[model samples]
Target: MRAIRSLSQGARTSLRQVLWGLVLVLALPTILVAAAGLYSGYRAEQQATDLRMQETARALSLLLDREIEKSVLALQVLAHSSSLARGDFEEFYDRAKTSGLEEPSWIALFEPSGRVIFNTRVPYGVKLPNSNRMDALQRVQETRKPYVSDLYVGSLTGQRLITIDAPVIIDERVAYILSLAITPDVFQGIIRDQRIADGWNAAVLDRSRRLVARSRSPERFVGQLASPNVQEALASAQEGLLQSVTLDGIPVRTYFSQSPTYGWSFVISIPETELAKSAQRSLFWLTVLGAVILGGILLAVLLSRAISKPVDQLVAAAQTLGRGGEVSDRASTRVLEFDTIKRALVEAAAGIRHHEREREEVLAHMAESEARLRLALNAGHLGSWEYTPATGALTTTPTCRAHFGRGADEPVTYADLIAQIHPDDRALQKESVALALAGRTDLQAEYRVIWPDGSEHWIRVSGRMRSGPDGHPSMVGVSQDITERRLAEDRQALLLHELNHRVKNTLATVQSIASLTRRSGDNTDPAAWNAFMDRLHGMAKTHDLLTATQWQGALLEDVLKNELEPYQDGIRQRIRLRGPRINLQPGAVLALGLAVHELATNAVKYGSLSAAEGKVHVMWAVTSGSGQPALLVEWVESGGPPVNKPERQGFGSKLIQRGLAQQLGGEIKLDFAPAGVRCVITFPISTMASDQSGAAETQQRYAS
Candidate 1:
């Protein structure tokens, strides 16, 4: 309102004067255009309605022809009856009667001249009526095919019927004519089933334009001729629509289709009342156009009043919103454009209010998230950056600039970031970024970055493509100095490879020793040599268990089970093992594995394991002895032959007694008492830290 009031009028004429003249000039063409629009719409609706009607007629025609074809097919099948050729009238009569012919229908045979041979409706050898359907038989004889007759009164039945005739050719000549006569009532259901709307009528008509079936008053119109308009249409075209009157005297627009097969027609008639709807719609448009032309006279006056109301409402709504208030009142307008503007203003104001609330909430969340992000980036030494392609601007934090070998005060560019990359990785980095852009995937590159001091460091740059505020492509990402982590990873890989080589060599030596022991053919005691081989296998199994943990440590129960599981064959409760979960350094895993193997071998040879019911219980747990934590594993045997202490300690006994206590700084007690052989191994529990390979080295060294 303020701006409009401030406008300077350079001329005397107001906009009303100019528009009043313009409306006078354009009113003639405007009327023409509106009339044309009305005509076009009515014509389009009529064309669509005509197409639908024509299709319905065509479909119904085909349906009626198909029904007649069914009768023709039945006649053809019955014509091949052997009874007809042999002149067995009684058998042929019975055959035709029981040939599944429809009720109120009959099959008959006639000579080519239409003399009746037999009729199924009468008894055998009875004098039957002469066949009066010679025209259909002549058609069959001439065409050498089946023929369908138009609606007619049958000479025998004395009722309106249609005939289907097939030629029973004998010796390449028309021998007999087989006929099936069905009443026109068979087609009444088909016409009625169309379910056309009220005031619309559908029908099936024979070739002579006589009604075979009618949807409206079938009893009155059936067998009667249609109006002349339909007859004239059939003469000119196979399918068409005509303005005519139905046989019942209803004025209608009729659509008709003639069947190519039976020369019959299907006609659908719509009352003129139904077709008047399109005309009514056209009249409605004409009235609206007339009102518009008259309304134009007041348009300039109304627009002048209408424009100011909406404009003033818009100003009022803006002021209310500017003052943090809501505008919800609405008023009617005479101009359509003003009404549209009012609706738009209402919806836009509501949206702006909703957006303002959402914007406040989002800004709060963003501030909190940004604080957490700053802490994480500083703690992890990550360098953040954002690039906008629209403005071609690269903005980075101080850390990102430092990552690219630039001072905090220096400006950075994409080219500078690329130039600082090591030459070997520069091309690869570019290729990765190109792929990221093309595939819409994240950009991740690990390459060497050369600092300004000429010292090389590995830097990993990661980013994701996003859309900027201007809807152009942009990137937001972080970079980090991963030089220390990369060095550690390299060192770890080397150490693992070396450890694997050493473990394989050690296991190979143990296998060689076991093989040599197996081949000790001259040994006096076979059990002794086999026992040594079994111990070697136990060590190899323990080695495998330790390797699964990267040679760091293993479970104590796992070590004992590996050595004893093989001896638990005969299932008379031969062995039982119980232990709490406890981890042992690799040295303890190896040493305890050997001690358990010797005890199990002895049990099988002469201890509890020798008896079918003999069993060994192996249990271990952590206990405090002498103010230090120690792992105590007890191996007890029962239900075996009596045992006694050996006067001279054998190799197994000496190794268990000496090697475990000396190398692992643990105590071992082997008691060869009378009841069973019992051994207890106690070792102080060691730390389960990652850097415990030295312990495994000692065990492998001792075995070698």
Candidate 2:
């Protein structure tokens, strides 16, 4: 202990000063050699710093991708749960609760429009509003692919988070979306695990160049945009190194790698001070060269020349490593220290290259994982069941019990399930199950179940038998609620019949128009033929709009917009249309489409649209303060040529007056004012859906 104290109290001495007193004349050559060595070492150290930074960037990038993959994998697993397809939210909620996921992570179910059905972040049955991730959900639905959303704020947690969404498709349509809300700490954990050194920086940025996780000042900078240098480096290359300043304005050399799977960039920055660390060995050799130079100038020159080549090689090797290129296995140098460094550099280059190869392989696998997530399988999720024939015991998922017409909490047994099946289909189901168990073939059966409420539903079951250790074959199978598909087939047949009846009615309407036009104008007139074709085209547009929605219905604004689209002026708003996107049923849509078509054509031919200064405003509103709300649409024209009432009503006038009443059970009023023509139509929403007018009324309305 006394010796250590005496050593600590000893004064420091300068080697150069002590040596200079003995060899003052040798100082010039020594300074020149030391300076040369110093410059070379500086360059080599800078290159090494860059290579290490680049390697750090790649390693962090791989880790970050793996972290994101975990969230996505969990989301996909939940998305495939059969309870979602069977409309069993309770089972889904329970499964999500026990998902075994870490904190700051939660699951959610969303409709295609972004309405949250349920969220595991909060208790079940909580009133969940629409999610703030509509754009991400919409993209997934459109592309039918898994997506990583940009940084967003969580609804329940109100913290900055990112979402990974996977679509649950049924009947080839995106029925629902499953998502995982991941806090930035999940990514920050990755950085924390790296244990990055002080004076160095690391960060993760989404595709928008916004910071997702930061190694420092995360609370203040987590969601902020990255520094300009980092952004440019990310944009410039898939992996690269560049000289820049940190977000804290510290000069640094930044290394970054862009993830091919998610398009995010991972960055690591090393300070400039680290690069300027002088090499101790090089300085020691320089002092030796100075002390020995006085013995022979030629020998000193020879030693200096000998060291220069290896220094260049080391620097060259580092540059090659930084560029991700192959390094040469050069022979050993004459200098022992240089030889050791050369070998080390060679090994490091190999190790880094090998790591890069592994990273590429991992990236490829992650891409495949993402691709598998997007495969659109046709089977709808419902429930799975396992049965032990020895004990006649049945274990079913919540969805499976629900398919048998039981509640989620209802206890079910094999006998109870068999009793629920229809009498006729029961035998067929038993035969299929028996055949599968005895012959070891796949079990396939379609049977009907009589619910306690007396509603009949179709269930499709498919499964296989597995041999147990006890020499008994256990039965496992999945069942689906195919009631919607079967009903769809029935609806298809009914629609075909309705289509035929509508075709005949459409012909009658066409005949009425031809007859009215023949009496009003000469049949051979080009104007009459043009008017007829135009009306046919208008009808075609309405059919196109309805077909796009599978004939379910369309918005009132869409029907009007389709009819008046030609007169729409983007800058002037000449044909002003103002209304909410009221969802009108098929009957209301068809009636409103034809009514608007007549009004628009008449105005373009003889009313306000005929004058240059003319304008038309078509507005609609749902009547309030009433028992059953009604729809009121008013078509008014102004700044027209004149207000001259037609002596005889043309087809346009009659169809608007009669078709609205026949097809929609509505009333229409057409009036001619000094400015132009005006028309008002009114109907009850309930009556519009019912279509009270029959085929006889339809033929009577067109009868002249």
Candidate 3:
């Protein structure tokens, strides 16, 4: 032992160095591990950033596509103007002005030669420069379809604008080109409204790679070509992510999508630093770990222990943040790096809270919008539904459920929905759904549905098929109850048919009246013709009364008042007309009208109405005769020249006797009383009473 102790201290120092070397070798992997961790973290951040950018780009692309589609739809509507088709330029300009007044962009109509015929922004006589490249217009004219043009400077306003052109085809020839000019301000607003991340920029490019709109510094970059790298990337793919430098020499990670409607590209470029921030933090921590490794072994152990506790605390805080929990200030570990991580966790928590609040607000707005939609549907008697063909699942709004006579909470399958349809309409509904799902055509059908209560309702359904997230077929549609409208149309058709029939019957009656008058030699003299005309006037007054009653029936009092109106004008007090408010059937009204006409004519000529001192009393009563109800009408005249029986029955008298007896199924007696003339007419009331009751029932049923 003494001899070993005699060895140099250098040997002991060398053994210690070897042990330290082994420890250094083992610690070298820690640096490598930290580097690998930093790289992995950077890759993850890049992936996340890419996903966000792609989503933003897609959303912007969809919004721009919708705007273009709206412009096209508006142009198509304007193309159908009747004035444009009729070659009325002045009228067409007026209509276009009215239509464009509320639009965000201006509208113009151009001749086939690219000459402005009408412009909403300028007067009719104002001349404007023609486009050097009229590819959009020419394409629309050739294809007879809508076309969206590349960005250009407006000739009138000198502002950057894009045009959507639709051809107005008449008689299989292009007649006019309707164009709508939209400014970049519209797309600028859309980009701003999207709430993109700070330090992130978005831009829109036309098919030619020219900048149509830029979310940042629009005035400087708009109308300029995009960066060469961006153009090359977009040219190769419809949508993708890539790293490119902006025109201002700022490197960015970009996501771009090409629009299907306009061939435009939407780009969302996030600054590279945003993605590098996480990697920088990781590298900084790795450097700190390497520095700790360079310290003495005991110091390294102490430093690791010190760093480990704070790191554990930071990890717990991060986990809490990931779970959407609030981070407390007590999470601070008093270590600079760890404290920074804690602060970042707290900020992340705050960001999550903010995002949650926004989500809640969005949900509330969606609820309000849904409520408004329901109210509108109820007001219009409309219902909406969605059906998934794969699952046979049907989702219906409350209004739609009610239309099918289903409870609010009832689960409805596609088959259940089909079952509610009327048997005659079920096949049609099935065929329409099949066609829609097959992408053959849109679904549109007017059909009847039978409710559980045994009542049928006519409903019009219109919808289109769409692909779900998984590419499965689904249908979204609206239904409207058109029962009342259908019934009204039916009533109108019946009225028209009745009008035609009544006109034919009236014409035949007029011929009969003329023939009867001529056979009686009434046309041989002027006085006779005048008397015949007066008789015809009486018939005309009765016809007016019947028409006013919708040909359903006329009141007995109304018939008498019409026939006696002329005679009673001068002798109001002398004429006494009284009767109960009895409704007569149309047939009864016509027969009674003729009989009253004859009676009035005779009275005006030779009876009480013919003299100043003459008086007439007309009355009717409902009385029981032979156990059946009967209407008894008596027309008596007094205070006139003494009445005498005619030698031969004239047409007037014969009409009252024969027509009243045959047409009214009644009895009539005319007595030549010395006091005056008295006529008694008796008819059974069964027909009129039954007819009145039936009409009342029909009206009540319809009302119910």
Candidate 4:
């Protein structure tokens, strides 16, 4: 204690020393607070960057998994094709070629012995290269499930690619392995299309820790092993953030996400420099504040006695500002120097508040603009893009990323964007882009993009080119999904073709009915002519009913009602009809209509309808027979006269028993009851009963 006191006394308490002491006291806390604020802000920014990286990696992982699943699904669908099942290798090869032409994927069928049976890239019977990998095929055969292979050099194309294989099961055994081979170029395109900020990087690693693709410097690093630090970080967790160095030896803040489906990982790495920017800015401001405070303290020391009150007030105000608190307006001191200083403090506070409010307003406007952009993109199914030809940079909206089957935050290049387009459409798209860039024409193209999952979409793109201030060409455009419109067009064509087929069938039927009617009797016979006309009218009624139902089928009750319409009278209940409603195909409708007409004619001439007191009771029902649903119809007559069997089978009887049976794919039985005539028809309900339920259930349900 004596030594420290003696040293302090030797230093001497000069006026400048005292002022320096005061400045130290005032500046220490402010400096400490500023350092703390800087650190806190740095931490917040670092955390935000990590979170964003994690989210991007996770999203990219999910997209890759979905793409793998889609490829497997496509292979499965191809495996089940009838052509493949029939062992028509030539036909199947043609179909596979056409299907994969857009994707530029090679579709192949391989035997269990690892021999290629068919490949879309080569002629039939050509053998695949010996080095072609068959592990995925073997796995599919063993598991009888789809399997996606790891990245490898495809022996046929001598390119880095992956294969997705599905087993074709036949007679409870694996008959063949269907495979779809895709190149890494597609996945590279996916990585390149991510919308990452500048200086950030992303990569996709296969199960082997080999880089399958990278968003930056892909051509340089793809197929190489990932950095040891990244591999170590991933080994510990399926998803996490870490501080690491990239393959290029640059330090970065990295995040990784592993895919459960494909055993692959997506990684996002942001340069550490980006996180340091905010901290550096904070330090700059702190240094400037310290300098200003030191200058003020020196001035205060010189005029220490005269400016004591003002300096104290100024210090308080500075502390308030440093703490980000509002300053209240004060009355003028009336002295010029004091008032000037006070006014400056107030104006500084006002300026800070004004800037803060402006910053908030700007942030709000940016958020609103983003929201509106999202709404427009979603509502219109639109993907917007901006392309700079010189830089080859293709910036896209979130919807555009989705359209290209990329993660929302992925960056894209012009080459990567064009590569995602279907091979068949790439030439045209390239030409259109060239024309636009050359200022020869506005760009417009309708093309297809084959996604990594093997799903294809039609896209219509429209854009205009503009010259930048530096005279470089750029394009602004929107792409819309037009798959639905294309499908509707296809459906319309199919419907038109079906309409033509039905019209020809109808004409043939009319011609046959006319010939049959003419041959049954002489054309001169008026009764025969009348019978033909009546039959024609009955056929027309059936057709009308069928037309009303769009030719899907006609209700049995509707057909019966039309045939019995001529016999109905206001006062007489001569015909009684009872049945559960049944739907019949067009063929059943025609045969049944003629049979009912014949029966009615017979009843009018010789059965119950022959006398006023006579009555006809017609009933139909669905019943189970031979373990299949069957339709049963009964015709009974009463109160006319004693019924007798026909001497010889008439045309009506043969038509009802034979023609009706053949047309309906069912059976018929004619019964001659003692008191009246009865006919019972039984037919399989396969075609006639649209609903397979028993007639009793149907009737009960209808009643309810």
Query: Each candidate's lDDT (Cα)?
Result: 0.78, 0.78, 0.78, 0.78
Which 10-residue window of candidate 2 scores lowest in summed lDDT? 695-704
RMSD of 2: 21.8
Stretches off by above 4 angstroms in model 2 are 1-445, 448-505, 518-527, 625-627, 687-704
**What TM-scores do the predictions have?**
0.40, 0.39, 0.43, 0.44
C-alpha displacement of 9 in model 4, angstroms? Answer: 29
**lDDT string, candidate 2, 142-255, tens digits:** 998789888977666778988888988875799999888788888888888889888788889998999999888889888889888778767778999888987777898778
lDDT against true structure, model 3: 0.78
Q: Is candidate 3 or candidate 4 better by lDDT?
A: 3
lDDT of 4: 0.78
Displacement of the residue 86 alpha carbon in candidate 3, Å: 68
Q: How does candidate 2 fare on TM-score?
A: 0.39
Tens digit of per-residue lDDT, candidate 4, span 1-704: 45645765797665556666877787888788877887788788777867877888898999999878877777787788899888898998888877743264788888887887877777877766542556666777889988777788865566888777889998589999888888777787777677667788888898888988888888899889998888887888899988899989889888899998888999888788877787888889878877887788777677665555565566566556657776545412324566788999999999999999999999999999999978887899899988888887788887887887777887766777678899999999989888887774678999998876788988899998877687887888898888889989998998899789777766765565566567667534446677767767777877887788887777777887878877876764888888886878777777788788888888888887788788888888776644776777888888887888877666567666665656677767777776788878777777666654435456331110
For candidate 1, write residues 396-420 as lDDT tens digits.
9999898877888898787777788
What candidate 4 gets wrong by more than 4 Å, as runs, is 1-26, 69-95, 98-104, 111-114, 123-135, 141-144, 154-159, 167-176, 195-201, 214-235, 243-253, 270-289, 296-665, 668-704
- What is the clash tally of candidate 3? 0
